[model samples]
Target: MSFIHLDRPDCPEAHRPEAHHPDRKLTARKLITRTGSSPPVHCGHVAMVTRVTKNMSAKAKQSNKSADKNANDRNDVASKESDAEKANPQWKLISHEQINTLLDLTVEQVQFQFEEILGLKNYQTCLKEASLLDYFVSGFWWTREMNYTCQQISFIMALLQFLLDNISEKQMPFVDNLNEFAKMISGTRQSPSPEVDSLFDAEQAMSITDYLKCSLFQNYQLYEFLFSQPREELLLGKKVRLPASLCPYVC
Candidate 1:
């Protein structure tokens, strides 16, 4: 058999290079030589991987920012608690700091100076009034529970204000529906942080209930008897006589 030479006219294609197809632009990257990894990498794949990595990094940064914010908030609360505690030992009972926005007297401080009302004993009129400090101490000890809302704090402050305001009154305001108040207090419990959509997130209700039971509710009848408007001394045991002026309720 005669050998076929590559340069022969009949063997023209054997020595010539392959021609490029018109569709090579579209499929150019689809074909590649095996290099060190024996796998092909395309520009599109590289871009896709870069985008995914960038997204993941951004998410990680957001997560870190949230964590840092929570941490800073916790630290701020701790600082406030420390400052409050230093100002008054009674603040020790508070489990957490509260946001008292309505009235500055609720949590920020007392209206009556401590040195004037709760601090001195020798200057106290009615020797029994000296024990007011003890009353506050015991009450605070009973109700130190804190909450996110201002309900419990405001209620406590209101009660204290009423007590102080009507200390010398013939009759202090009395709850006509003690049972209803009790029911409201005993209504519901909640997590420290319930859903925003909740209608009855009243964890402080029970806290107030326990507090009143421990401090105020137990002395309900005593408060009415000691502070409420008494019948006229001349009409006592005979006929009832109303007070000259009634308590201003709307104010």
Candidate 2:
């Protein structure tokens, strides 16, 4: 009996067994010889790549959020510090012992004098006025000693001249009393007797250098002693007012 050789290499196409289905037909040789991947494996690889890309995108978004939040936090802190500075204008220096010695008084005595000069019923008000005076006087001394520009020196000198003019015109009791107290402490004239007209005339053509020679600038220690206290202590209970004429220069 003759038997059919199905697995022979020279098998005829017409006589060979047909594949199970056209779409599903595949052989080990065909799979190995193909240059591209199979559908199932390709889909799985694409899905893995997509998942990795999504994870990277998520991480990037999270990093951006963290950066934004940190920026906001820094800005908030800066804003708060700025607000605090504005709300409370304080003296830059605080050498209590030096100030006491300069004034020839104890801390307690300085406080008392401040209260008396400002006519402050509350202790806190005295401290605030003292700090303000310190800031003003220190600014003046620094500007003078550091050789500030002529324009800058002139502006400050003009402001001071304005304040002095106002004090004389208003006859502010606090300034008069403070001047007297300063004179007593220094054993030198703090200012010309209040009766002696104007120390500086806005209309005058005097130089800033000439203005500095006046008693106000000469007796700077009086002001430094006034502002030695803490700023918060100064504004605890009262409102301080700048002279109306000086308001334009302040802002």
* Highest TM-score against the true fold, candidate: 1
TM-score of each: 0.31, 0.29
Clashes of each: 5, 2
Per-residue lDDT tens digits of candidate 1, residues 5-120?
76566676554443224343433333343132334578899999999999999999999999999999999778755643332222222322432322234322531333243555
* Model 2 spans with C-alpha error above 4 angstroms: 1-41, 95-251
lDDT of 2: 0.48
The CA lDDT at 19 in model 1 is 29
lDDT of each: 0.47, 0.48
Candidate 2: tens digits of C-alpha lDDT, residues 1-251: 97656556555643544532447656656765664654355778889999999999999999999999999999977875564333222222333343334245544564555455435565435654545444345444544464544333334533454444434444445455455433322321122334433222333224433444454555554444344444545344566798999999985
Which residue pairs overlap in candidate 1's backbone? 170-228, 170-229, 171-228, 171-229, 172-228
